[model samples]
Target: MKSSPIGGDEHPRPLIREVVVINKQGIHARPAALFVKTATKFRADIGIEKEGEVVNGKSIIGLLMLAAGEGTKLTLTAQGQDAEKALAELSKLFEDKFSED
Candidate 1:
């Protein structure tokens, strides 16, 4: 998984409002995969920040390293032509607790 792979473009980026991982287990393999799956749906560069490290939001490995334990706050950023839509979708996924059951 790459970190901040997409860059050098002069496009505006949409910053994701703080999203807290309320899920008890935080981001595990299953949820990480799910999160990346959602991020791939749009054509935008997405990034997730944790502890000052920014990882590619669409990469499973990157997301897992975030170690977003329960209540951990994450900042998602999407920049590209469709940044708004991508950011919205990504945020929605987090809001849904990665669809954990």
Candidate 2:
């Protein structure tokens, strides 16, 4: 889904990426917090989905509800001026297992 425009002459464009949780601990407190922190740095709106349940990427509580353990697949969506960059960083986080063991 597209997000509302930010600056002048800007239009929302949807961007989506899929990743699997490879971290041994999954997306626990620290990783979720890191996800939210990274999401907030972008101008795009972010959402994460697992098994069709979508949640706000910026909310720690929302992410916790998913209980995304290792091997859980998630869809990451972003829309706005910085969507490309945001997706790249977020995807890297998942690919890197949030830097956890």
Tens digits of per-residue lDDT for model 1, 1-101: 33344564456646565678878889988888988998898777889998689999889989888888888888888877667788777778778887775
Residue-level lDDT for 59 in candidate 2 = 93
Model 2: clashing residue pairs?
Answer: none
Model 1: residues with Cα > 4 Å off, grouped in runs: 1-10
- Mind giving the per-residue lDDT tens digits that candidate 2 earns over 3-99? 4465542556689999999999999999999999999999789999999999999999999999999999999999878888999999999988898
Computed on alpha carbons, the lDDT of every model, listed in order, comes to 0.80, 0.91
Error of 2 at 85 (Å): 0.2
